[model samples]
Every structure is written in C-alpha cells, then in structure tokens.
Target: MATPDAPPTPATHPSADDVPIDKSTPDAEPPPELPENARARRYVILSFWLVVVLLGLPLWWKTTSIYRAPLPLRDMQSWADGRACRAEFPLLVEVEAPELSDPEHLIKSAQHALDDANDFSAHHLRLRLASPKLTDSTGNNAEENVAATLKLLPGPARSSHSYQLSNVSREIELFYSPSYNPSSSASSASLSLFVANTLQEIFAEEQQMISHLLSTSTPAPSSASGDSTSGSSKVNHAEIARKMSRILRYSPTYHLTFSLFTGSGTPTSWEIEDAIDEYLQPLLGALSGISNFTIDSQIQFYASPSDNVVPEWQPDGEPAEGEPQRGKWVLKKQDLSSFINSAEWPLASITSYPTINFIIYVPADELTPLSISGSATNAFLLPQWGGVKILNLPVEKIDGERKTHLTREDLKSSLDTFAGQLMSLLGAPAHPSSLPIRLDSLTRQRSAELLTSASSTLGSLYRLTLALPSISIPTSVSTAVSSTLESLQNACQELKQGRVGGEGGALAEGRNAAAQAERAFFEKSMVGQVYFPEEHKVAVYLPLMGPVGVPLVMSAVKELANFIKGWKASRVAKA
Candidate 1:
C-alpha cells in the first residue's frame, strides 16, 4: 500500500513532444477541372451572348425604329417650279345678231379684229354666233357658260352706234343704225371694228389683272408676236398688289357678324336682321356661286373707342348769337385707324371658316357727330377684316325717358356702304358696270392666286424635308401630298379648258389643292417629330443599353484573357 501511494505522488502529465502521432493522409488537392467542364462553361457564356445578339438586340431595334413613308420629292419640286403644268385661259364670247342674214361673216370679221388687237394670247376671246336658246325673253343670258349676251337692236334713223350694259343682267345692248348692213364689205368691217374695240375696252381691266398675275407668279406665256412683255407697261402693278393685299384668301365659306356697339347703355337693340335681308341679301345671292355665307348679329353696351381716338372741339357753324358757345367733337384722320377697340370686342366667331365683322359703333350724347376730318362719311373698310361705321343717332325723349333703338331705315346708308366694302374685299373689279363680268374676273384672279399659293406651299414642304432629315414623315402626309398634286393637275387642266369658276371648276380644284397642301405641311406627327433631336434619342437609349452592355463586354474580355493564357502555356510546353 505504501509503495502504491509513493508511485501515485510521483506521477506526471505527458509533454506534447512525448504524445503519440497517428498520421492520416492530408486532404488531397481538388482534382484538376476536367477539360470538358471548362469547355462547357465557355459555351454557356457564348450561348447567352448569341441570344442577346440574335434576338434581344433585334427586338429592341424593331420596337424603337420610326416609320417613314417615301415621297416623290422631284415631282413635287417640278410642280412647284411650274414645270409640270402650263395654265392658260381662253374665253369664248357669243355674238347675237338675229337681224343679220349673214352672222357668220360678222363673227369671222369680229374674231379677226379681236385676234389682231389682242396682245395677250392666253386670255384671247373667240366670237361665235349665239344660239337662239342662249338668251331669255328678257334679253338676259340664260346659259351659265355664256359670259355676256350681246343683244343687237336696230337703232332709229337719227341714232348713232352705241352700246349700253345692263345693270340688272349680263346683257350688252348694241344699238346699230338701220342703215348698217352685214353683207356690205365696208359696213361689215366698220361694225366688226366697233365690236372689237368695245369688247377690248370691256375686258381691258381683266386682261391687265390676269397678265399681272401671270407675270408675278409663273413665267407668263408669250403673246402672239412672241413677246411676253408687250403690254407690261400698261399694268399698274403697285395698285394691283395693294388691292390683292386687301382681299382675303379664298375659302369655301365665310361668316359675317353684324355687331352694334354703344358707348352708353342706350340702343340696346337693333333691327339688324331686316337690314341685312334688305340690303345684303341681293349681293350675297349674286356671290352664292363663289362662296357660301352665314350671318349673325349681336348688341353690346358700354363699348368705348380706343384711347388714341381723341377728338378736337370745332364750332358748330358759328354758334348762334350767345348760344353758350356751341361746339362739336371731331375725330381726325389719324384717329380713324385706332377707332376700333379690338381687345374688348368679341369679334371672334366659333365657325371654322373665316369671319368678316361689320361693327356699328354709336357714340355717346356728349360726343355726337364724330366725323372723320376731311371726309363726309363715317364708315371705313378694314381690308380683309370688315367695315366699321360711326352712327350718330339722335336720342329721342319719350314719356320722360330716352328711347334709343335702330330701325331698318336708320341703317340703310350704313348697310349700303357695307355692301360696297364687301365687294371690294372680295376682289371685284370696279369697271364694266356688269356684276356678272366682275364676278367672273374675280373667279379667275382667285384661281390663279390659289394655284400659286399651293405651289409655294409644296415647295416649302420639300425644302423642309431636305433641311430636317431626322424628322419623321407619316403615311398620312404622303397621301395628302399625292392628293394635292392630283388636284393641282386637275385644276391646271380645268383652267386650260377655260373653266374658271363655279363648282368642280379650276377655282374649286385649286382650293382643294391648297387645303391638302396645308394639311400635309402641317401634319401633327411630322411637327411633333421635328423637336425630337438625335441628342434626345441618345439620352433615351443610353440608360437601357448601359446595364446590358457592361456584363457582355466584361465576360468577353475575361474569356479572351483566359484563352490567351492557355495558348501561351501550351506553346511553351510544345517548345
């Protein structure tokens, strides 16, 4: 027991050096990646890139690309330059001489004289014997195609050769002497010469207008003598230009607004409907063949003139002896221009067509008889807009109250002035004393104007397309341009055939062309695309492309680096 105790006290722990070692094999290095596995990984990355290139990229491009319709730029330019079509007007005049046994000779002689006297061949008149049915019992032209009816009547023995134009119809009465004979060569020559001279005088203004239009627009056709400027010296180009500037652009419809504006609360109502019906209906009926019109009326209270309309005091015909120095307010000529308070006036209409406003402004009692200096009239035209009249109405006292109202009689003069202004604004010629003839001239003028305008618009559109290559052109615009070109060609053909006015004529077709050209030029899609620049496209695409492109580029670079490393190692081993 003592020996065991001594051994236990001497016992000691084993040191790390004396510990026993059971050595197990260290973990083997991961097995070298198989060649097949490495190849499979590279192929996987390549498949992803192929999907992105073949499918994703093409899809994005297809979604973002703009659709542009092709256009015929060259054809458009040719039309604009007046190379595609040549416009000409050949008028036909009918001569009615029922009393003459041989009207054919008279017609032949007159035509010869007309041809010799005509300097502008494009607007030459051809004389033909009028058919019996062309004139009505009242001696007016029943055929719309006939410009005028020449009624030949035998004059009294004492009467001389004379002609009178009817104010109510398109008839020219030629009073030939009873001694005149169509079979006699000398008499025929004299009568033919007279007729030719009269016709020339009647159409002189129209010829000048048409010549001016041709000279100002496309190259004019040469005269019979091969001179284009033969009669250029006779044209008043400045006056024609001024008158054209005042006329409104052609439209299918027009809205006329008659407004009565008073400086005070009086004159709350007016018989404008009756006045228009009586004074304006006749003129409107005459112009119905050209354009349609819609009428409206209104009354406004407390409408004052512009601040520039300051009036000066003038004595009223030397005040009666001690009549408290009677005086009247007079507006100067300069003030007439600023008499309209457009800012406060409700001049705008809701119709889509153009609006022609006629205002009747009644002055206050304190400023009655507001007359323009150096002029007896108080009405003035506003040129392409409308007319204005200063109505100095006398206030009537009834039952201790003021009665201010406009009757049809009080507005007669103003309405007459408005009618005249309307004609001037509509480009009616002021000669020949024949309404139908004047309207015909206006029709030709408007047709020429609209044709030129449409051509100019087409040219501008073509230039715009060239200037802004990035702007998108829609299919609608292409269709509109084609329609416009077709209409222009039709109009030119109609003009060449001498169909100047009326529905389905040159004027109507020209208007259609102009409208279509405007629509094409102002297409909303094209205009919207104009502001979207290449920079904007870049800004829009960069964010989407950045994330997708970065990974693809990095993967490609890594794969390339690995491939180069393997190639170098294999080369060195082979060496």
Candidate 2:
C-alpha cells in the first residue's frame, strides 16, 4: 500500500495548474439562499451612516466648536484702518499779559506769532489769553497741561527771559518798552519775537515726537509706493524707532523695583524709600499723565552666574572687567541677560498686580571682581520690562550686619543710578524738555501703539477662526474682544480731545487693550485641538464595518444577478 501511494505520486505529480479548477462549487461549502428579510442588512448600514453623519456630526460639532464673541469686526477693522478715530491733540495753551492797548489785539498778535513759528502740524500750539485781574476760577488753571505761559510784565527793564522754573509759575516774562506795541496789526516788540521763538523752541521736541508717532502708526495709501515722502518717513523711522523702542508702552500702574545686588555682602538694605522720594517720586508723579506707578524694592543674596566665564579683550576694552569675577567664575557676554540666579533669588513675590520685578543681583563674595562676559555693554534694556545693574559691595562687617546686604546710606549713589535707568526704561521722550511734556508724549504713543496692537490681534483672531476648523472658541474670548475694542475706542477719544493727563488715562486704555488682546488671542481653548482624527474614527468602526459589510454585499450581489436573469427569461418567453 505504501509502494502504491508512492507510485501514485510518481504517476502524475500533478502541477498546481494540473489540479481541476472548482468553478461550479465553492471550495468548502456553497452559500445559502437569501433570507426573506435580508433587506434588513441595507437598513442596518443606512442607520449607521445616518447616525455618523447626523447625530454624531452634530454632537462632535457641539463639543468641539470654540466660543467666539461677536466682535464688531467692522468697527475693529475701521479702527485699524485709521477711520474709526482721528487723533488730534488740540492743546489749549493760554498766553497772558495784563498790560496792552487792546487785549483782543494783543491776543491776535501772539496767536499769529505762534502760528508763524510752529512747524509740526499735529502738535499745533494755540494761544488763549487770561485776564490780568483774574480770580481762582479764571486765573490760567495752572493744574491743566499748559505748555508754557508768556507773561508781559510791567518791567521798568529791557528784554524778555524765562524765569527760573523754581521761582515762578509762568515760563516766560517779557519786559515791554511801551514802543514794543503794534498799532494796526498789533505786531511789535523784540520781546514778542523772543517769546514766539522761545515758545516754538520749547515745543519743538514734542512736535517731532507727535509727528513721529503719527507717521509710524498711520497706514500708507495703497498706491503710495516708492514716493519720496514714504521713503523719507522710513528713514526718519529708522532713527525714531530706536528711541520709541527704548520707552515702555504706557501702563496704568508701573512697578518700580529697586534691588541691590553685589558680588559680596557689604551693602544690604538701601535707602530705597528715602532715595525714591528724593529722586524718583516727583518724576513718577509727573509721569502719572501717561501711567500710574507702584514702587517696590527687594534684595537678593548668594546670587551668581550659573556658568563659568572667560573674559576676552576687544579693540574697545576688556571683557566684563568690573565685578563679575567671583569664586574663579568668569562668564561670557552672551550669558548676561540670563545672568540672574533666578533659582535662588526671591525675584517672584507678589502673586499679581502687574508687578514688574526689577532685579538687583550681587554675586557671592568668593567671586570678587564681577564683569559681563564679553565686550562691554554693561547695561542692556529688556523691552517693556525692567533693568539690571551690577554694583560691587565692598566687603565690610557694618553695624553688626555680617554679610553684603545693601545699607540705606551705601545705596544712595546706587539709587540715583537706578532712578536714571528707570526713567530711560520708561521711555520718557527726550524733547518737550519738561518732565510733564515728555510724559504726555508717552501717553499718546502708548494709546496708539496699544490700539494698533489690539486691532491687529483681532484681525489675527478673525483669520484664525477662518483657518482652524477643529478649534473651539469660548464666550469669554468674545467678551474680551468686545471689551478691548471698547477700551481702544474710549482711549482714542481721550487722546484726540487732549483729555490725556499725568493721571494716565490714555495709557490706561492702551494697557487694557493690550491685556485684552493677549487674553483674546491666547484663550486656552483656541490652541491644542489634537486629540482625534478622522482616520482614527474610520479605524475604530472598521471591526463593525467588516462584519456588517458581508451580509449587505452578498444580498446586493444576489439581488442584482437575479434581477438580470429574470429579465432575460421574460424576454425569451416573449420571443
């Protein structure tokens, strides 16, 4: 039998092609006929597809859609378009002189003089006259933002001159010779000429500043490309942008931090309160027109550069020469911005209240000579933020205090330096010469900048809404956007009418706009929608799909073949 089986394999060794093809019958078993209710398979598939498309789609959309507030997009776009608001700083400057042939004519002469001398269009200084015999209600209102006052004193003397700001409330005192009065036109006097020129000169810086802001913020005409005016503006911008960037955008409340850090422990507690009052508060009060300021002071101990530094000399000078060298530690210039030992220092204290923490870092005593790592640029500004100063505290055990914490007396000089740095960082405009005028300029700039930034953010949000299909928006975002737009409008109105104050109204508006913009753009729900994908849904349902598909497909095939065969049979019978 074994020989027979072997012989059978030898007999034919049928090739794969030689095996009979099972065409008529299925390999294992034939399919049963369609059940009477087989059409139920189609109903099942239809139900699943309907659920996925209708109920499932609605549920997914309900769960995933982001809350978008109905922002007045047209209004916002108009604001961005420079159409919603026209910022005109109508400065009401009153020029007064009790003695004159005709008060109105005298006023006319000064007004003409002002118009002649003025160049910057936006910051036009207009003149109003105060009655010589004035009372508390009408006597110039010195509290208001008066650029300057020209008083014609009955000087049995010669010419015109500015009185020392410490003595007089008036800015200029003109000594008229009586012959200095004009008859017909009411135009006469070298004193008047001097007053005109002097007044113009006083506001020159302010004028340029306002112009700089206008040109930068205003949108250029669509076809106004390659124009000399446009090119000239950009050239001016290159210079102006530097100064503007240095200045902080207006904040309603600025946190003034005075920190004393030295490489060693000699000076610990600084005369921060006394020194601030002496050198900083007056300036801060003047700046109140642009923003309110909160004063804070702190001291850090055992702070040093995280990395080792090796100094290199440049053509200019040595690398980090002063106090950076501590405990054989030397850092390069590149590492200076991050030089603060944030891990150890108590830089973060107040939980909120828009606190700007200005850190004063004094390295440990072991590394005595501290210096920046590279070529000298000892102090650098972190934009819209605080500053850093490296003060070398001399090693001394003073008043039973063993370590190098700054003392009030020891910090006198350091506080002065900090005061100077603080003013610079706050972006007080160089011109308008007076602290008050500079602060006003800062206010206007902040309002405009904040409005522009916030408007741009809204535009971006609108674009993002169009772009991100899966992202969900919440109602808070819309509410914030609305609030921002309202704040921007209100601030714009304040600035245009010269309602700007050292109290910082415009600056406050700008701050609100900026804060709101940040909130709107960075709503937590707007980002991070990466949990599920369409292909994944397809994958999860595939198991059910495979099983459900078999019956429906078989039913369809059998139905189609039967229909065709029945039609053919009917045709044959008719023939």
Candidate 3:
C-alpha cells in the first residue's frame, strides 16, 4: 500500500515554475527593447528614407529626365498664321529712250497710267530712267536690277506703230510713227497708255498666279465692292490647277534623266551629250537663277512598251510596186498615261533631287513609223513627271544589213519638244515671248511657294508638339527652328526689297528656311519618345520598385501610427 501511493505521487502535467530551466537556452521571448534602441532603429529607417528622397530620387531624375529645349512657339505660330511676314513684289522697270531729250516726262506719264491700271497692290511696278552713259554705248542694259527694259524708237515715215519683245533678252522695243511727237501731250498720253497696257498684259498671268497662291495658302479678305482684280475673277482655277498639276514642286535642284528605251539592241548608243549641249543648255542656263540641274542618261535595250500601250496595226499607205507590204503601229491617246513600264524599267531616282524623266522609245523595224492616234507629233507629256517621244528610226542598209543609231540631228526635234515641256513643268508663264521675263516670273512664284511651304511645316510641327506633350524635342530641333525663323525673316526682307531671285536672294533664303524646317520637323529623336510613353516606363519599373517600395511604405505607415497613438495617449493622461 505504501509503494502504490508513492507511484501515484508524480503529476501528469508540470507547472511552469516547476520546470527546470537550462542556462544555455534562451527565454521564449526576450525582454522589451530599450527606448534608446527603438529610437535608434527609427532614426536609421528615417535616415535611409531621407537619403532616398533627397539624394537618390534627384539623381535618378537627373539621369532619366528628357532634355527639352525651349522653342519659339509663339513666333512659329505667328509665321504659320501669316501674321509675321507679308510678301510683296516690287518690280523695277527701266525706261531706255535715248532719242528722247526729256525721259522723265514719259516715265512720269507711264507711271501714272500704270498706277491707275494696276489692281494688285502687292505687285508694284516702279519705272526708272536708264543711265544715259550705260545705254548710249551698246543699247543694252548692264544692270540686273531692272525686271525689264522698255526701248522706244522712232519708226520710218508713214510706218505704223508696233511693239516687239526680244526672245533672248528682257527688252521690249516700241516702234512709233515718225509723225508722232513725244513733246505733244496727246501723243505722250497715248504712248504712256500703250506702255501701261503692254506692261499689264505682260504681268497678268503672274498676278493671277500670285493671287491664287495667296488665296489658297491663307483665305484673303474679300473686298466689299468685289471690284478687286486680285480676286478669283481674274484667276482661271481649272486652268491653273491643270497647269499646276503639270508642274513639279519648287526645289533648289532637279535631276534630269534622259533614257532611250529600244525594242531591239540596234540603237545602243546616242549623241545625247551633244544634243543636250545644243538644245537644253540655254534653257538650263536661263533657269540657273531659279534652280540648278543635274543631268544623266542611260539606254535600255530589248525594252518593250507597257501592256496599256497596245498598238493597233495599220497598213502603210500603198506599198511601192515589187516592194513587200509594210504596216505601221498606232498608240491611243487614252493609253498614254500607263505607257511607262515602271515595274520593268529602271526609272528610280538615285539622287535626292526631284527627277524629271525624258524617255525616247524606239520600236523594232516591224513597228517602225509608230504614231499616236489623232496627234500630229509622236510625243506626249506626263504631268509632274516628264515627257515621252516615240522616235521611229528609219531602217538603213549598212553592209547589206540593217543598222540604226541616234545622231544629234535626229534628236534635235525631240530635244526642242523636251525644252518646251521643261518650261511648262517648271511653271513658266507662256506670255510676253521673253525668256528673261518668264524666268523672273518663275523666281517670284518659287519664292512664294517655298515661303508658304516652310510656314506650313512649322505650323505642323507646332501642332504636333501641342498634341503630344511627352514627345522629346532635342536641342538640335530648337536650333533648326531658330535657323528656319531667321532665314524666313531674311527671305521676307529680301522679297520686300524686290530681291526675289538671283544668288543669295529671297528664293535662296526660302530654300534654306524650308530645309531647316524639314530637319526640325523630322528629327529622329522625336519618334523614340513617342513610342516609349510614360505608361511604358512605369510598367518597366514596377517589378523592381514593388518589392523595395512596399517595405519602406509599410515601415513609414507603422511609425506614423505609433506616433499618433503615443500622442493620443499622452493627451488623454493630461486630460
């Protein structure tokens, strides 16, 4: 009984105090940390956050922020809106009448008549007397300041009054009857009126073109009386559109490609260099003031016409006795547009300048004497492209075999046609019969065109910047824009001063402005930021920042909550 009682003495569960504690083992929970240590831990975390906020954030921003240069947005917008510059063409016409004792009277009368007749104020024609010394020697104008020279001479007795414009120069000669006296007021008034009318006729097309350009570029205010000749009344919109469609856009330079496409390999080479020198050099020289030209030539053998140019077979008119029957090929006018086989031909431009292709296609012997239906000449013009001449070479017997080659003489007519087409494609006016006057008109037109083009580009760029706020604009773009604005200002000044053409003139300045504007608008760096937007950057950084930011944010929140609780507790105790 005593042994059983001793066995039952041990309890199943022992009390916490009854358990034996090991000195090597630590307690289940450590003692509460000292306030100094807790404060130190908070101080360390706060310091880390302060480093990230003050130093790390700024460093990251400095390294990653886009560099955007300040642009002259207002000035650009002003230029685009046509408020900055108003183009004016002040033409100077020189009077050279060596026979007249007092030229000033005639000039005054003519100027009065001109002022009264002219409806377009933007094109002011100022008349000035030529220097006696300069005109007395050669009767030629030595100065390039005048747009044209008006030459007055007394004709033979009983001869009728007539006027003729020099084809090679800017001189317009007026031959009056010997009976007509310059001293008589009636005769002087009549002569002055005639001169004014002639001048107006010479510049009518130019005024129309300028008016059209102004109206199209910026809507001009309509006159209350609607008597303004500068309105659409004078402009033939359909004709202008057709002409403009045929003309290539204004450029400082153009590349000319003269290609000879042959169905057979007989005509492998041609005297193109000589032909160009003789027929095209003069035109090119005259246009040098407006633009430069680069010319090249190539010959493609075994080249055939496109499918659109299906030729219809027609028997040759009454074949000679004992001669084999011959046939001719005819091309339809409707199919001329697709005659150029762009897919097979090498018509691609190699240079940066706009290319004008002049094609001379020669068919095989069987298809000789090819002609277009209902057309006199075998030539056609491609609007804004170039011209095509279907040259059919006569088959000649050489060493009892057929042979064909293009000589300078053979290419003369084609070259002449090409020259005329070139003038048309260059926006040259068909009036006055004076090459120099037409060239001057071209200069003014090109200047206006380039100025408007540059302004439009600047406007587009400004709009794009406003639309895309995140797009990066580099310093180069700002520099280009500044240069463009400066050049535009200079061009406007030149135009105002009547220096619209020639070296370092309004045209040149406008070209520079347009180039700079294009550079600014097409900056490659601008496209990069457009593709990589703010949302994309955030997405890229989310994985890395999530882990790091969560810990920092939670710690800050916990610390703030603890501070608020401690503050409340202290306030309660004090109350």
Candidate 4:
C-alpha cells in the first residue's frame, strides 16, 4: 500500500544466504579468544559415564532381576534322594496266656519265631506279655500299647485248636487242648508255633500293603535283589498301578457330594437330610478321627444318564431267539470315565479338598425298572470318584405317574452302597472287618504317601528354578517351603516313633505339608510370563535407547582419542 513512498517491497522474502551484508558498519573485532578448559571437557565425559554406571545399570538390574525365595535346597535334595528319612513300622503285640505257668517263656519263643519269619527290614513285630491284672479291667487298658492281643483259652478234649476273634474287642482267643502246654524240655513249643502262624496269617494283608507302598515310594536299591527280604518286599507292578489308579490322592479334608438326579419333574424332593443322618452319619463320624468330611445333598430334576437307551449287541456265541433283542444298557468299564460330565455339574461350594461325587439317577417312565448289568446290584463304582446308583420304583408302575418323593427307608440301601464307595475312593483298605482298625491303617498309609509326595514336589521345584533362572519367586513361597520342611521333619519323626494315631495330629501335619509344597511349587507368579522372548524386549526399547546412546558413545570416543594424543606428545618431549 506504501509502495510509492518507499522502495518497492520484494515480491517474496529473501533467504538468509541470499541477503546482502552491509559494509557501512565495520564488523566488530572478534571477542578475545577464550582459553580452552580441558578440565571441563573431561568433566562432561566423566559425568556421562558416571550416570550410566551409577544410575542406568542399577535401574536396569532392579527392573529385570527375578525374586528368588530362600529355600533349604540341600535338605530338600537330600529328602528327594531318600537319604534323610527311612520309614519304619514297629508293631507291638501283647500275648495273654493266663493259664500258662509262665507266659514270659511263650512270648519269647513266639518272638523268636516271628523274627525268623519276618524278612522285610523296615517293618517288624515285637511281642510282650500282658499283665494278668489287665484281664479284669472294664476298659481296654492295653489298647494303647498293643496292635492286637492274643488270648489263650482251655478247650474240651478232641479239639486240637481253634481261634476266635472278638468283633467288639481287639482280642483273638486261641482255643487249645489242655495237653498242648509248652514242655520245659522241648526246644520248640507247639503253642508258640500256633501263635506265630496265626499272627503271620492275620498280618499278611497289611504286610503286603506296606511292602507295595514302600516299593513305589522309594527307589529300589541294586543290592535289593541279593537280599533275603527282596521276594517279600517285591509286589506286582500291575497290581500297584491298579491300586494307585483307583484311589484318590491324600488330603486333609474331603468333600462328599450326594446328588439325586431324576429324568422327570415329579421326583424333585428327597428325604436326603434324614437319610444321611440315619444311614451315613455314623460312618462319617467314625472317619472324623482320620479326616474331616463335609457332606452336601441336592436333588436335580430332568436329568438323564450318558446314554438314554441300550444299543444292539453281538455276543461271542449265536444270539438266541427268546433272548431280548435290545442289549442290556451296560455302562462299560471303559465308558465309566465319561459317566459324569464335570463341566455340566459345577461344584456348588468351593472347597480346598477334592470333591467326591455320589449320584443317584432316576430314569424316565419309559426307561423304568432300571438295573445295572441286569443283576441285583444297581450301583457301580467310578475309580477315584464316588458311586452311581440307578433308582427303580419299588412297585412297577407301567401307567402310574413317577414316584414324586423318596422316603428315608427307600434310600437306605443305596446310601449304604455310596458309603462303601466313599471308603474305596478315599483309599481305605477293606480288611480285619473292623472299621476302626481299617481307618487306623489308612492313617499310616496316608502319612507315608503325603510325605513322599511333598518330597517329590520339593525336588521338582528345585529343578524348575534351576532350569529357568529368570522366574520370580515370592516371599510367601519361601515361608511355605520352610513350613513344609519343618512339618515333614516332624511327620518323619512321628512315623519313626510308631505314633500313627490320627487324633495325635501327625497325619494331619503330613497332609498339610504336602498341600503347602504343592502350593509353593506351582505359584502363579513364578510360572506366568516365564516364556517372554528377548526379541520382543529389543522391539520395545530400541526406539528410545538408540538415539540416546549414540551421542554419549561418540563423545566418549572423541575424548579418549584426544587424551591419548596428548599423552604421546608429552612422552616424546620427555624422551
């Protein structure tokens, strides 16, 4: 707009290089050259290195390092190697021969026979004489010290010998002819021989069970084949495998789920509360000493079996004309694994211990008169799980509506079978016909099992940590490991002392220790993010650290070169 008064403005701005410098103003003399501060340059280089060493390195380590908990690695390894503990069972047997002139002689002779008969070094028998005064005691005074009591009674003539075991007590009465008394001159007593044979027979099952457990728990020594007890200790591998497959793992507590599943809506109610109280409570009460059990019952309507109807079958021989064309609806042994769809039946209550499912399915009207294997038993056992029973109407009602309710009396037999299945699934042995005695044996077996399991878990944890050096371990893992070791030591000591009473707290300690070891070994934090690759880390930090490191490295190299040049010049001048 003011182009007439002033020189015409340039159409476009001129670049800095294109602009002309005015010569009218003489360039001011350059300021006096400042002295080069070699010290300052050196300080800059040193400061960069100091920051890297003092700050960067420590920060990287703090972020990338794995947290490892302190564990008794040596002790755990020793335990895994089977050097720390050797399991032993010293059973005490009391002989009661009040009729004998001297019971002490009989006990000594029997003990000698037992010692000769016993081949396994870990398990042995000790015989002792019972006091005559204990005979009149109202309560079992000697139950604490004796696994079993041998009582000798005088029998009538013509009866050589017979034995009777008291169902109510731990006493076994041996009826012998009055003339069979031990003679002072005879080196081997007949009475002692009888007692030894009976004892050997009575304990045969327990000995076999113990031998199987020991064989599976520890590594077999090379010298075992040369030892005299090797045959006695050796058990069939297939049998041991079968036993391990059938029984559930040891736990401090067990949850028992009793469910009534019906194909129709009418049979929705059950007298389950009363039935459990009347039929199953007694057994649970008896097992309370060894383990805690929580019972829950429910009824489900419109439920069906895995297969609704029977399939056609071809027998080995030719089919008969009169035989039913439809094959029996048999749940084959192989199909038992898929009998219960676990995903469909989520647990109602969350529990630490494993859930044992007991199912009673009532079929639809069309599939009534249900029978398992077309036999008297309508129940079958699921290995490591509970039992299943198919309930059929007591009165065959072809047209009538399905039974709407199940009374306590109607559920008694099925519940009884469920109780037996419960025992089997828990790994309890069926022997001695005494519930208390069987449970006691189960306690000892469970303790040994838990101890072995815990040791093996600890070994696995050690190996895992060694293999993956970058995995994180929390402080809780350390505390759990310590507790597990301490509890295992205490359990081992208790076993060594032959203190296997469930109420004495030894068995529970072993179970708890095993659980803790499992928890620590499988800690969530340690296993997660263990497989992150190094390439991914480079991809994440390359953009940020690349530019930052370049200038620092170049400056350091330049400084080093100058310093080296100065050093050589000084050396030459000195020469």
lDDT against the true structure, each candidate:
0.81, 0.59, 0.83, 0.72
Could you tell me how far off, in angstroms, the CA of residue 497 lies in candidate 1 after the best superposition?
A: 2.3
So what's the TM-score on candidate 1?
0.84
TM-score per candidate: 0.84, 0.68, 0.86, 0.80
Per-residue lDDT of candidate 4, residues 449-522 (tens digit): 77778888888887777777767789998888888888888877777666776554558778778889999987
Best by lDDT: 3
Question: In candidate 3, what are the lDDT values of residues 1-575, reduced to their tens digit?
Answer: 36544445655798889998798996689886788987998998899899989998999899878777899999989888777876777888888887888879988999999888766666668988887665533344455456787888887789866788888777888886677777799988888888888888888888777767765764222211224424435588787877888989988899999999998887878999999999899899989988899999999998888877788888878899999878778888888988999989999987999999999998888788789888666899999999999888877767876556688999998998899889989998888688878988988888878888899899988888998877879999999999999999999889878887767799999999999999999999996666776788788889988998899999999989988988999999999
Tens-digit per-residue lDDT, 57-165, candidate 2: 7997797455555666676566656556555555666666666656566666666877665544445666777644442332345445554456666555563344322
Inter-residue clash pairs, candidate 3: none
Candidate 2, residue 146: how far the Cα is off, in Å: 4.6
* Alpha carbon deviation, residue 323, candidate 4 (Å): 16
Better of 3 and 4 by TM-score: 3
Question: Model 1: per-residue lDDT, tens digit, 61-123?
Answer: 898677778888997888777677666667777778877888888889889999888767767
**Which scores greater on lDDT, model 3 or model 4?**
3
Supply the TM-score for candidate 2. Answer: 0.68
Please identify model 1 stretches exceeding 4 Å from their true place.
1-41, 99-106, 137-144, 154-161, 176-194, 217-233, 320-328, 374-376, 395-403, 561-575
lDDT of 4: 0.72
Q: Model 4: runs farther than 4 Å from truth?
A: 1-39, 58-69, 132-145, 155-157, 166-169, 177-179, 184-190, 218-231, 308-349, 374-376, 397-402, 469-475, 529-545, 566-575
